[model samples]
Target: MSTTALPDIRAARDERVVGALALALAASLVVQNAAVAWAAAPSYAAPMTEVLAFHAEHRGAVAIAVGLEALNLPLLLGFLAGLRGLVEQRGGAGAVWSRLALAAGAVLSAAFGLYAVLWIGTVLVADGLTGPTPLLELVWQLHAAAFAFVLSALGTTLVAAALTTHAGRLTAPWQRWLGLVGGGLMLAAGAASLPIADGSSLLFVGMPGYAAWLVWLLATGVRLVRRAA
Candidate 1:
């Protein structure tokens, strides 16, 4: 197949898998978020505590968190592949933005993965496997950096996808709207990550935006697949 045709082929195959990956990722995200959200509950103690508090308290949930978190690696790879597939086949402003956005997402995903690992390390330390360390604090700093870049990617991709269409027209107002809303949410989320050191409660405010971005990403993937088809 020609180079241009290759992405379409990949996109065709990816269309069969991206939705499934999205579902799995979303499920994992919900579980992960639930754990975080639960710990943030007013009834819960350890207001000054980090995520280690939650993992240590709910051991079962910790297993769930770790399991769900582990699944993200493959899902993220698949997402990046799908984005690449779109770009290789389409090769337009939309595709370029999508690639950058996916790159940002990948960075944030990696940072989150590192954060989970740090949490696990803290657990190990509490279990007497290691010494006390500032792993969690380091994870938070990485989180801030990852979120900043991810926000930029989100905004660029959303706008690019909104303005360009397969038909080569500046149509698809809904796509544009998704871009604006999703982009806005990411920026808000990035801002929220900054003040997180002051209090964990502020993280709660960022959740809705991330949640919206997830929804928008799923929708955008589906739209890309349909357009390619």
Candidate 2:
């Protein structure tokens, strides 16, 4: 490794940076839950719930969670860039795969980012219309984008593990296993929504599962960075 590369690895391992990133991700997760709550709350409940129901009745309201989901994209892109630096510095044969992982990460991020923007725009345009669930409008495409994000994240982590040297190893089997389980939970959450005709019922599983996955990702990333340091 080049003398300069040491600092780059060390930066990737920085405790404070990692912690801040975790907080950011956690906040995004919070927004995701808020979106779900906004959807699931009854229309005749208290002031807060009623307000949420009002928003839920509109397309713009659904955009809130999508906006939160987009927030992860830029941060993930930066994380992948850091990983790329570390992989290149190591000059390992796994570097090729690491690069591929980074590409996957970028693709995943971009896909979600675009989803967020497009749907938010759709919501804004269709704000007060009492028509069919705009969700069903691009349902399959949105689901595919979401699935790609989950799978790409898993692929990225696997390649990161493969590329890390002994000195750079920042993850353990427990963490890896938790990640696998988290991904599975997210998949289940998505699948569970398929049969639910009610938007509220679908939000119950899908929203919380997504939040759980984000929390897991944030926590694991922090642990790995701290361990590396």
lDDT against the true structure, each candidate: 0.54, 0.52
Across 64-103, the per-residue lDDT of candidate 1 in tens digits comes to 6767778876776676556555455544545655556566
RMSD of 2: 6.5
TM-score result, candidate 2: 0.58
Model 2: per-residue Cα lDDT at residue 176 = 48
User: How big is the positional error of residue 163 in model 1, measured in Å on the Cα after superposition?
Assistant: 7.5
Position 61, candidate 2: lDDT: 50
Question: Cα RMSDs of all predictions?
Answer: 5.6, 6.5
The candidate scoring highest on lDDT is 1
Point to the candidate with the largest TM-score. 1
Clashes of each: 0, 0
Q: Model 1, which residues run further than 4 Å from truth? A: 1-11, 35-46, 49-53, 91-93, 125-172, 192-194, 200-202, 221-229
Clashing pairs in 1: none
